[model samples]
Target: MKTSYVSNLAIQTAMRMTIQQNQMDLLKATQEQTTGRHYDVGLTLGATASRSLNLQREIDRLNSMKSTNSVVTQRLSGSQGALETMAKAAEKVRDTLVTYKGNDAASQLKIQKTEILGALQTFTAAANTSFNGEFLFSGINTDAKPLADYTATSAAKTAFDAAFTAFKTANSITSDDQITVTQMQDFIKNTVEPMFTGTGWDANWSDASSQNMTSRISASEVIESSTNANTNGFRMFAMASVITAELMDKNVTPEVRAAIGVEALQYVEQGIAGLNAERSQLGISESRVKKANTSIDAQLKLVNTHVADLEGIDPIETSTRINTLKVQLETSYTLTSRLQQMSLLNFL
Candidate 1:
């Protein structure tokens, strides 16, 4: 048997190295115990570590999509609210028109004009509503206000005045009372009607785009998230309101006023229908978003569960390992202290 003498220095160095290693193990075990996840997933799971990483990435992607969906839902809700306000205002005007159509009593006609003007103002306000600094009815041009105010000095009012002046000059009518029903009808058909359609409408009335805002509610599903003032309904609403408000106070015959009422009432009805259609489409999108969120929630739960299964650790096992490492580290420290005291000088 070969006899070898072990030096105290050698034992101390070995014990110090063991203590450092135990400390590292204890730290890792404590972390694993607290998080219930592996400290070194690559070493523990080997080639399958990539699977856990992929699942976590999927979770992140889903979370990002959910965040986006939240914005989409907010925009949709705001759009719906504005549309509701517009629809209600339009409905009120429609009721007024139906109740007083062809009733040319001076006081009654004045009341009707006042109500129509007020409704028009309400419609414009709602159409220009903004959310989060974006105009709700501006379609994809969210930064721009959708509708121009039809005030006395506005371009729309100027254009209408010019159109009416041209009509009167063409018809050789010097006075407002000289405008007969036939002349008025001709003016509306040839001049007023065209102003609210196509380029004329764009130039004078609306700053909104025809293409509405679209949002991706899910990976595979996208939907229109907004409407604009360029729609037929909005055009009709402005047309009816403007024509009645501008012409009702003119010194025209009751026959002519009654004729104007007939045409405006028809336009108001059409406008109401158009607004209803827009509301219906938006409602459908809202329902779809709700369903998409439900699906996303389900996907998130499934992906997170998979990630946990792949990276999870046994808490009991990790805790036991932590305690064992702590004891080993303490023993090493004690041994190192004792070894330091056992020098040849001390023995002497």
Candidate 2:
């Protein structure tokens, strides 16, 4: 039989290693208890760690979508407000035209012209409204102003002058009042009307895209998120306002004035209808976004519950293990102390 004697140094070293291991276990158990989660998820989950990883990725994705949805909702709300402002301005001008139709009284017609011009200015401002540093009515061209200002120096004003000058030259008329009701209607139909369509609008009035903006509100759903100034409603509003403001002060008879008022009112009504339709379409998209968020929230709750179950630690069991580790550390320390005292020199 071979006998080997173990030195106190070796015994103390082994006890110290055990104490160190117990302290580490105690720290891990305490963390698990406080966090209510696994401290070493990969180790504990082992083969199923991939499942936890995938679920966490899903949570991140859903959270990102939710954040994006919040921005989309703000944009939609801003668009709705701009449309509402435009609609109200149109309605105010329409009412003024209706009330003062055929009056031809300089004061009343002047007031009516002022009202129409104001509405046009309001509409233009609304059309060019911006939200979050982007134009609300610019469609995909959000970085640029949607509608050109109808100022004296603006392209829209220059185009209108050219169109009207051509109309006067074509009819061989020297003055606005010399123009008959039939001639005025012809000018509007053939000249002013055409300017609001095709390349004319794009070149002179609108910088917006005919194609509106679309957004993904959910994983599988996408919808039109914004409307553009190039829509018929916006075009009609500009047309009616320009005609009323520029032609109302003409030295024409009440009959001609009435004819112009009638034409403008018709255009204003059409513009109102167009704006209402845009609002309706945007409202639908807003509703869909809200519903998508609700669904996402539901999915988040379910995914979080599964994640909790997968990575959760039992507080009671972790606390018990912590206590056991503490007791073992204390015992190791006591044994180490005894070993330190058990030197052969103490016996001598």
Find the candidate with the highest lDDT and give its number.
2
Please give the distance, in angstroms, between residue 11's alpha carbon in candidate 2 and its true position after superposition: 4.6
Candidate 2 residue-wise lDDT, 1-348, digit = tens: 998976878778888899889988888998899889999999999999999999999999999999999999999999999999999999998988888877877898789888888888899888888988999888899898999888889888898888888888988999777989999888888888888866789999888887888888889999999999989899888888999998888888777888888899899899999999999999999999999999999999999999999999888888889889988988988998898999778989
Off by over 4 Å in 2: 1-12, 326-348
lDDT (CA) for every model shown?
A: 0.88, 0.90
Per-prediction TM-score:
0.88, 0.90
User: What's the lDDT for residue 330 in model 2?
Assistant: 88
Please, what's the RMSD in Å of model 2? 3.0
User: CA shift at 208, candidate 2, in angstroms?
Assistant: 0.7
Error of 2 at 225 (Å): 1.0
Candidate 1 versus the native: TM-score?
0.88
